[model samples]
Target: MHDGAVDLKAEARARIYAQPIEMLDPAQPELFATDAMWPIFERLRAEDPVHWVEAPDYGGYWSITGWNDIMAVDSNHQTFSSADGITLQSLESKAETARRGARPSFISMDPPRHDEQRKTVSPVVAPSNLTVMAPVIRERAGQILDGLPIGEEFDWVEHVSKELTAMTLATLFDFPQEERRLLPHWSDMITNAPGHGPVESWEHKRREIDAMVARFTQMWNDRVNAPPAGDLISMLAHGESTRNMDKAEYAGNLGLLIIGGNDTTRNTISGSVYALNKNPGQYRRLREDPSLIPSMVSETIRWQTPLAHMARTATADCELGGKTIKAGDRVVMWYVSGNRDASMVEDPDSYLIERARPRQHMSFGFGIHRCVGNRLAELQLTIIWEEIMKRFPSIDLVAEPDRTHSIFVKGYESLPVMIPSRN
Candidate 1:
């Protein structure tokens, strides 16, 4: 009996409750990949589905660790708001007191304003629009596969995945192909997981991201004068709502699109190659039956779950899973843990292309914030696999692949693969 302590169980609960949030530094990517982190997630999901992470440096936040709890948080967006910022803290929140600006887009907006802003670009991402874009995505995939080095080891992450998604996004936005590389570069800087890459300070990288936003401003101005037809920029430039977006908002939305398209889809492709190479039986099943490409795509999303978690702010004090969440408290919905929920997924750890109800995974999220580009991402992966199957029946991963140490945006930093040349 420790002095002034409640019963042991109550004391332990109090300690856990009093704990500050575990700040996931955007500067390091390894924190998310630590073996310690994985087991913690497992325990959190089983015992405390909504655990508090005590991160004094980055401020604290609630960690929504289970499948049902995450969906509950996502579905009730009025309570768990996105308007504060999508991640743990907005660029403004992370900045020194002297710096901070108005937010950028609907990804972080709430209610009527969020609805209004979202409607501006919704049509462009609708299913019908994706169908129209399929041929364009497929054409680029074929060209990329043809250009691969026939019998040499190459970084599939850079050459195949990044290049393909970048070009496709450029086509979607009608941006110049030569400047396509800028999309990934700016995206990396904007969402640099603390301790993941070369980004040292948020303020420094934010300035770079702001500069990129300025470039979008110029593009918006140019498009307003002479907009290109059948392109997102043209639509935004001349449309009713997007046309009215201020320079900052316009730039932020554009940044959002680039980040959404470049990293998530590209990583899935790179991860798919790695998954197939490592899981020979699953690979053979797909290689033998080309139809499994769709299911294979779903499996890849489950296995990778790019962009692991997105945070929201609690609008009011409330109780969740017998725990209290104060108003303005940040709530992080961990999709990585949700996908592995035993109740939701059968044998959650295994990768099965033919798994029944293959589309149930939370890779693209659920409810309102579900990825608008879901169809496009699926198209990219399916096309890449199609081309891969046609060109080479087997791809051997030559290097021990490395994962990005990121709590958000899960994928490979380097994936070396040996593709046999039919030539």
Candidate 2:
């Protein structure tokens, strides 16, 4: 099945490369799912940095493929408003979201309001907070690594990546430890396309979301009734700005926190294993010098490019990358493409753990809307690698991973691996 997918991707790449620049459309989700979007992005970055793609399902949208161009769009929040939405999904899906009463979080709001709401939970992941949590994270990482089956094949995504991230997320929210798995589940349901993975239909997704909102709402009520605490729920409940949010807005904020806490770091954890296995030299270097763990973590994030793209609507006519974008145009900054741009990154396709500037990638975005939980993500990855080095001699991938079928979240569904026991 994997070979067949690769063959199809090769055929698609040939056809795409042969086509005229005016005819290319890179918005298709299959390209990302099958890991075949590299050639398409390479072509766009070289030929049309600011490419306009017209898809049958998603209509016309601008693809910002270059690193500098993406930075420009990401930084200029005033000109490209995130309020219109941030994915290249069909307009109908946007309408359906509104119909289902999906509220807009601060991520989707512009300046003033965005800043106001974001401040509520910003301190939870602050440098001071992360400093205090590092030892705790390392301890948990040690516990998780110690429990892995030795010389036995297991799903790394479930036993390691998801478990560690879910635990940290539970800690961040002060959520019930046993119910921590539900956080990632809610995130999956929120981002998965209909008929993909766990989502069977739009109705099923809606029902799942409704249940998630109700659960969180109950937590919110409980938190609000108690004395203030540092968990996310308590922060929002007692926050001067967030305490009065309506139901939809509350749900929207919850979704943001869940996805922010779950998807990015979890995928990077899985990606680190896959990347190291694929780049044996780097893995050897890592084993020889475990101090390179921080660099390895950053490089893995760049290599994975967890969240593929972020869409923005042009608030005014703007000229970028030699293209004139009109008002209200949907401009998508493909971070996956930018992270791989040869012009910006040295040997961008290769995963090197000792890069001079490992943290120079755009995975966490830029400017004011940059990820709030980025430090925590990095800390978690660093701690996990440290613990893994202390325990296992090596972890071998048993087979190709089952990747999630979505362009938005570039993630693995399952990664089979066997850990070699230490002597």
Candidate 3:
């Protein structure tokens, strides 16, 4: 690490530790943007793995940082219910959401309903479909990479990461590929809050949602009227469990799918480049053995846990980590923190693409809500890297990334990069 970066991390640690433990609210979005959340998670994991926060805005929420504890909370969905909604939304935001369009995605539902609803869209990413999609991803990735101007600075996130994911996302919904840019924008609107990031205000966000609803609802109507097809919209339109869904439910599902299909993979694509830039040794090793693409993909997902946290409401009074979590209390399992737990992962902070057990991380949650599109995300990363290896020997990170300002979506907004020459 550079002397300045090391000093900044040390400063952040001191400042974070100087504050009282009880006052810590892990949901703060600003910390993630400035990349200061790492030290905060470091402190939380060390002192109070199962910590509590009683913020006026957030009310009371539990932050689970340890790997095993997070796994327990994630797997036992019955006790830690997702029905209240995920990602630690504030009371005001929750109320606003209900009034705005009631985006009640299946990911937030429990049991039979969640399973049935999720089942409708699972086929899009099935092994057979992923096989079909792999070559398409490679072709698009190659085209995107080829289009980049050599020896000139450009935002990698815009040119490659976002471009590839947006196309894939558009295909999954059978939406117009030309309008693929809207997919990531809608995903941003889903997680954005007034003043925190992309969203300017609740009204501004509501307007964005309105545009999304109009577009998605039109697609839903078109797909529902047509014969059953292979895309996600058609699957939901034809599936018994989803066909009768209400408007709000449909909007919710669309938002979830868009965000799910975009964020994790896009962020990780950008993160992979940044990680390799920082850990040049790993990049050198990878360039020599292109066979290590899969391992590198898994390691990048682990290193850049795109989703920071998923919030669950306790269904009943439960004992976790020797603490009593009352029924109805908000509990947030920090995937980002668990992915960095040294107890489970050796040298967790270090970015090692060739780790022995690279996929042993919580970037994709466990149990019923485990990411359905995980394999597709991996496939995209693997194919992109494979295609990239066949082109450029290295991508120069011109500057640090412009990260997203949300504790929910740990991602990049822009990553400036330059390729000096193609191999």
Candidate 4:
């Protein structure tokens, strides 16, 4: 860990325990960046599963920390609505984005509209589609692994995680293969605020968004003029539901698809490597039985809990966990907390690869807004690990990863590792 960050994290951990129960707030980006949010969540789950924080600047919100509570909010879409926004964004950020002509993506929409828009592109990841994509993904994973440098330390987040992410996203969008890196770059910009993640400033983020708008607009026109094809952009251009969407709506959905496609799989790739390195016994078990790859993939998703929380607004007064929630209150279901809720998951903290039911977790969420690309994400992880076990004996972590400075994206910005001699 970086000394300065470690010091800050230590202080935060100490403060969390010492502070009044009502004063505990686990939404700080700094805590997530330093990997110190665990204790806060632990205390909340034990003391107050449904906790409320009063931070006007960050948007005062209720944090639902227990497994059942999160499911209640996620499933009761009538009471807890996603129309307001998906993550906990400050009031100002929403206004600023609106001023920039950005609109809500399908993830932020409710009912009929959300269902229609989501279905338009859902075919790409359908069971039949996944069957077609499996071999293509494996071939690409092999190429990515075969290109790795042995006996040298490199940022795996950059060379492997993001590289493979960009390639898969490139194929999904039918973007130029050589310039595939732009997909992850654009994702980073969209997810970050000024002084956080990969974004340097508001101006920097604005420029990147503008560039994305221009390029995607050009592609939209090109695809609209031509016949429909297999790519996502083309699907949007020709699909009955999405064909008539305005520019702002088009941009919003693109942001959803791009970030969703990039972050979850990318973070989990890095997380799997880090988790295995931390638990050598599980790594040995994995090596002994390659069939454990699928189970290991699901377990890592639970352990990592990428994309920590999804926010909802209360549509009506409701009772949850014995607390009365008023209309229009910001309700955040902390999936990261729920995934590790011992009440639901047995030995939730341990990185166990061969559990009886590894997929029984809330990492992909629940109800209507459940992650649409979950199957594809699992396929990628399974294929990559299968490839890794076939080629290298081990890829050791050389140093601690630099985590993302955002509570919303539980991801790494950099991970150092070495492939000590390929098999």
Candidate 5:
């Protein structure tokens, strides 16, 4: 049956012969924030942790919510495969795989290939590399905060967080700063779900992807022929394992790098500002003690869960949390829900900046697929928060923030704020 005519609930039941499941209706985005499905998650964690969600509009799949179940799916690459794609629904799975093709990045690979490609860049993203980047990131953060106009309302998403993250990513890739803004736009075009952002048509999205691939193609040739000193592009271009990467693999890896490096970091920054604005006490506490920036940043990521759920297609028949899953069934690990898991996290509601388990969040994911750029993201966050506190001492939300309408990435699209001039 076609998408519109299919019964998602029945389809879900057929896929996993466990407790009957309810598909999350995309129509209600607030369900994510209102803790609507939370009680169900808590119930399942106590009972059937691997619950199936058969939702309409998007194709149906199983929703794995508990921390253990999420990790099981994340770590067991042999049983659960990322090669199918890493988001909800079979449509997205198929489209992404097809679009990615032989050019699949480490995000879409399993085992040996994943490990090799992941290793090539892991050192650059390690804590040591982040330490090197911290001051550079801090300097940029200060520059962005310094450039903000005093007492005037502006789009924080565009100006402060997005700009900073984009610039940093550009610097890492050695892309011209003026030209790097297109990276975010290209990422959105490739991944933005239906009914969100500027990716209005499939044809348009495909064309955009082709254009982005073409740009990367040229860059790849340039880097391959005349390698730079030590940028990411140069590393990819010259690395022994990555040098002979085919065209599709090269382009896909490049696209994955852009999205993985930019989106979560940018969104978390925007979300942190909104969170702090809503919780004045937490904001005050953070500003008063700039040392709390790291914990505060982790709290922001846990609170935002920016990367949302990542999908894994079952490679072998398996049973999980009392549910039987057939081979090839899509298993979506809901990081957003998992991050808020009450059993693993304390309270799970209050945005306390001093939460002791600061890095315990799943926003960067877990196990092998854990974010490679996590330290860089955190370093950038710390830098930004420190600069904001030092330069302005105080900031306030001027209006209700706007959120992007995508289930895969949770973040604000627009946030207006007022930063008083310290001068």
Candidate 6:
């Protein structure tokens, strides 16, 4: 662990037992970045599952730490609106985004409008579509694994995780394959805070987004002019509801699709390698029985919880888990914490690939807002692991992964690993 992580752990340790449970703040980004958040969540789940904390940066928010509580909040979309936002952005940042005229996406909308817009892109990842995509995904996964440098250290996040996801995302949008790298780049800029990770400033983020809109606008125009097709752009251009969307709405949906398509699966791919290495017994079981790939993929998603928390605004005063939330209060459902709630998941902390009900996870939000691309994410992960088992005896992690510096995206920036050459 880095010195920063050590300090955060020390701080958490000092606070976990010493401070009042109501005062403990689990939304601190450093805790997530260092992977030292488990203990904090564990403490919250035990002592105060519906904990409240005030922060100078993001203001006061309620942390719903338990699995059932999170499910309640996620499922009760009418009472907890996602329109104000689905993240813990600072009040200042929220005001600034509004000042700059932020657009609305289905993820941040409610009721009739959200449903109508979501249906536009739902078919892209439908079961029938995934069946058609399966072979293409497998072929890409094979090529990516075969191209890895055996017996040499390399960044797995870069070579395999990002590359494969980018390829799939490009195919989804029918985006230019040559420009596929931009998909992840835009996703990073959209999610990362300024002065952390790739984003240097909010201005830089704006410029990159402007470029993205320009590119997508051209695609939108072209697709609208042409006959209806199966790609995401074509779906949006020709779909009854989305066809008349304004620029802001179009850009909003594009950002949603890009991040949804890129980050969650990309991080899970990296996490699977790290998780398997950390649990060698599980790795051995996996190697011994490759049929466990599907279950293992679900387990990895639960263990990783790629997207940590989704914020919701209380539509009206309500009581939850013994705490009262007032109207307009920010209620954050910590999926990262919920996924590990021992009350719900058996031995939740351990990376047991062969769990009886591996698919019962909260990584994908529950109810109507559950991830539409979840099946596609699972497909990518399953294919990659199957391909990995076929080629390499083992992949050894050379160093600790460089994790992302955001609480929202539980992901690795890089994971150094080496694959031994076959004799």
True-structure lDDT of candidate 6: 0.91
- Identify the runs in model 2 with alpha carbons over 4 angstroms from their true place: 1-6
At residue 3, what lDDT does model 3 achieve?
72
> Model 3, which residues run further than 4 Å from truth?
1-7
Candidate 5 TM-score, C-alpha based: 0.88
**Which tens-of-lDDT digit does each residue in 1-423 have in candidate 6?**
458767877886866778677668877778777777777788899989998899767899998999999999999999999998788887667876987898778899998888988998999999999999999999999988888898899999999999999999999999988999999999999898888778998899889989999999999999999999999999999999899999999999999999999999999999999999989999999989999999999999999999999999999999998889999999999999999999999999999999999999999998878999999999999999888888888999988898998879999999999999742
Instruction: Give Cα-based local distance difference scores for all models.
Output: 0.77, 0.90, 0.90, 0.91, 0.76, 0.91
Supply candidate 6's per-residue lDDT for 365: 98
* lDDT minimum window of 10 residues, candidate 4: 90-99
> Could you report the Cα RMSD, in angstroms, for every candidate shown?
6.9, 1.5, 1.4, 1.6, 6.1, 1.6
Q: Give one digit per residue, the lDDT tens place, for model 3 in 1-423.
A: 457766876787788899998877777777788787887788888899999998777778888999999999999999999887888887788788677646688998998999999998999999999999988988898999889999999999988889999999999999999889999888888787787556888898889888998988898899889999999989998999999999888888888999999999999999999999999999999999999999999999999999999989999998998899999988999999999999999999999977889999999999999999999999999999998999998898998888898878899999999999989
For 1-423, candidate 4 gives per-residue lDDT tens digits of 458867877887788899898887778887888898988999999999998899655767899999999999999888899888899986667777776865678999988999999999998889998898899889999999999999999999999999887888888899999999999999999998888767888789889988997899999999999999989999999988899999888988989999889999999999999999999999999999999999999999999999999999999888888888999999999999999999999999999999999999998999999999999999999999999999999999998999998879999999999999888
Judged by lDDT against the true structure, how good is candidate 2? 0.90
Better-scoring candidate (lDDT), 3 or 5: 3
List TM-scores for all candidates, in order.
0.88, 0.97, 0.97, 0.97, 0.88, 0.97
For candidate 4, what is the TM-score?
0.97
Q: Which residue runs does candidate 5 get wrong by more than 4 Å?
A: 1-48, 89-103
417, model 6: CA deviation in Å? 0.5
lDDT of model number 3? 0.90
Cα deviation in Å at residue 19, candidate 2? 2.0
Taking the candidates one at a time, how many backbone clashes does each contain? 24, 0, 0, 0, 5, 0
Error of 2 at 380 (Å): 0.2
Which runs in model 6 stand beyond 4 Å of their true positions?
A: 1-11
